[model samples]
Target chain A: MKCDFCRETSVIHVRHTDKWFCEEHLVASVEKKVLETVQKTFMINRNDKVLVAASGGKDSTNLLHILHKNFPKVEALFIDEGIKNYRERSKSFIKKFCKKHKITLHTSSFKEEFGTTTDQIVKLDSTKTSPCSKCGVLRRYLINKKALELGADKLVTGHNLDDTCQDILMNIFQFNMEKLARTKSISPGFVQRIKPFRRVSERESMAYSIIKGFESNEGACPYVSESFRSLIREELNDLEFKFHGSKVNLQMIFDRLVPNLEKKVMKNRLNKCENCGGPTSRKVCKTCQILEQLK
Target chain B: MVTLEYPDGAKIKVEIEGSLLKVLVKSGENPEEIIVKKDGKMIAEDYELKKEDVVQIIKVGSKG
Candidate 1:
């Protein structure tokens, strides 16, 4: 089939927009969408240093590439969860990509910072809490600490539309309004976090990565299936398959709801964690609390 | 004839002058499980299709 804009054979058809594009147009379209999101959100300033949290996956890889291409000051931070096969494979890819792009890459590991790997922590857990729950808290804590130390003006993540929408649905299903409020695009007293691909879907990111010739690691973590998120993700996918545009509609509804929800529910003051000296809503941060349990 | 493109690079040709839903059904796609878009705008099931309209049929699902 011919591309909608040019004579090149079309490679992708975006159904939500009814647009067909060849390789060049598809890459341009993806980059254009990300740039539009960043501009619309006022996510970055001219002098700001953007620290991207990359996991060597398609979403983060595409994010790093796009942000580096557009922004003058962009670097990457990778969290080594030490999940055996996954961490090493992803790290190799990240190192190679960053080196090739001439972007400075920072590395932090759970074992080095917390004295235990995610795999170790999961094995030692007495509470039936999913490993993802613990790993997420630790990863966020470490990333925040590292970003501040690096004096970054903003933190960028590769959370695509699917991840954002799934989190929203999960929070609603669990009746966790405070968690939902925290999902707002901005929060005071924290490094301004931006998700430039919040409107882009996962499939699009993978396609973009391939089309752009990015060598990304596509392996899934072994513990991925243990999270409630995995369940929600599957259900959302099923719903979307049955109802086209369902995911995009869900995200649109979330974007409309988050601002008001933040005002109403995100009232918890940021308190300094007594142990780690990081900002948290509680006295001892969730990370500190988890560390205490692991000890 | 309207050409419908799937996610896996598969294309289906259908001859339908009615709504997008009719074309989707003719292409052997479950109308409920597919999203149809023409000219980069999502068209409802009742959206009319003209000759040579390139309808992109995206299955509503993501691996996140």
Candidate 2:
């Protein structure tokens, strides 16, 4: 189909808007929305030490590239979860991308920080402990710890509109009101998190990476199908298919509810986990609890 | 006869006469999660299939 704005053949069909865009316009559209997201939310300052959580996935890779374009000093952090044949490939891509762009990148690992790899954790596979669960907790813990150590003013992620919608739906279904409220809430000893792609769709992010010639099709986590989030992702995609703009609508509803939710849900004041000195609402943080279980 | 090409180099031959979107849906693929290409150029979902047309289906962001 022809691009709505130009003579070039359209490569992207933004369903909700029913608009077609060529490569140039597609990039411009996604970047414009991201820039607006950052500005509208007051997400960063000119001198902020911005660190992007890069996994070499389409989302993060796109995020890192976009942030670096706007903020030349933006660096990236990669966490090797030690997944066999998976994390390594992603790390290699991230390393090459950083070197090419001259952006300093930081590296951490589950092996170094937790004394165990995700591969090892899955082998032990306690009946009550899902490997995905452990990996999620540990990954979040390490990212925050690494971000804090790097003295990053803002920790940015590649979370897109579809991912954000999935998270909101999961939290609502699980009655995780506090978890939802505290997702972006400021707390001591933690780097503030921001998602520039929160309003951009996943497919658009993939298209941007492809058009930029840096998209990696490999490195999908082998155990992704085992997670509850995968199911939520599928369901949300189907809903979005049946009704365009469903994901954005869900985010709009959640955004309106969050101000009140934040006020109502911060009752469990966070305390430092004695073991890790991380912020936690409980006596011990979920990361510490997961680590103990692994042991 | 139309040939469907996947990124993994797998090809499937199907005798279908409809829009690319319909053929994809019939094959149990989600239209939202994929982009189709003809002659190395991206094509819209509603692009109609021709006899013996070979189109590349590049799976997009979604795992589904």
- Over all chains combined, what TM-score does candidate 1 have? 0.81
Interface RMSD for all numbered candidates = 7.7, 2.9
User: Per-residue CA lDDT of candidate 2, range A46-69, in tens?
Assistant: 999999999878888888888899
TM-score of 2: 0.95
Q: Tell me, per candidate, how large a share of the native contacts it keeps.
A: 0.02, 0.28
For A122-187, candidate 1 gives per-residue lDDT tens digits of 888999788888899899888888998899999989998878988898889999888888876455
Best by lDDT: 2
Which pairs clash (backbone N, Cα, C closer than 3 Å) in model 1? A17-B40, A18-B40, A240-B60, A241-B60
True contacts kept of 2: 0.28
Off by over 4 Å in 1: B1-64
Docking class of 1: incorrect
Best by DockQ: 2
Over the true interface residues, superposed, what is the Cα RMSD of model 1?
A: 7.7
Model 2 CA deviation exceeding 4 Å by range: B62-64
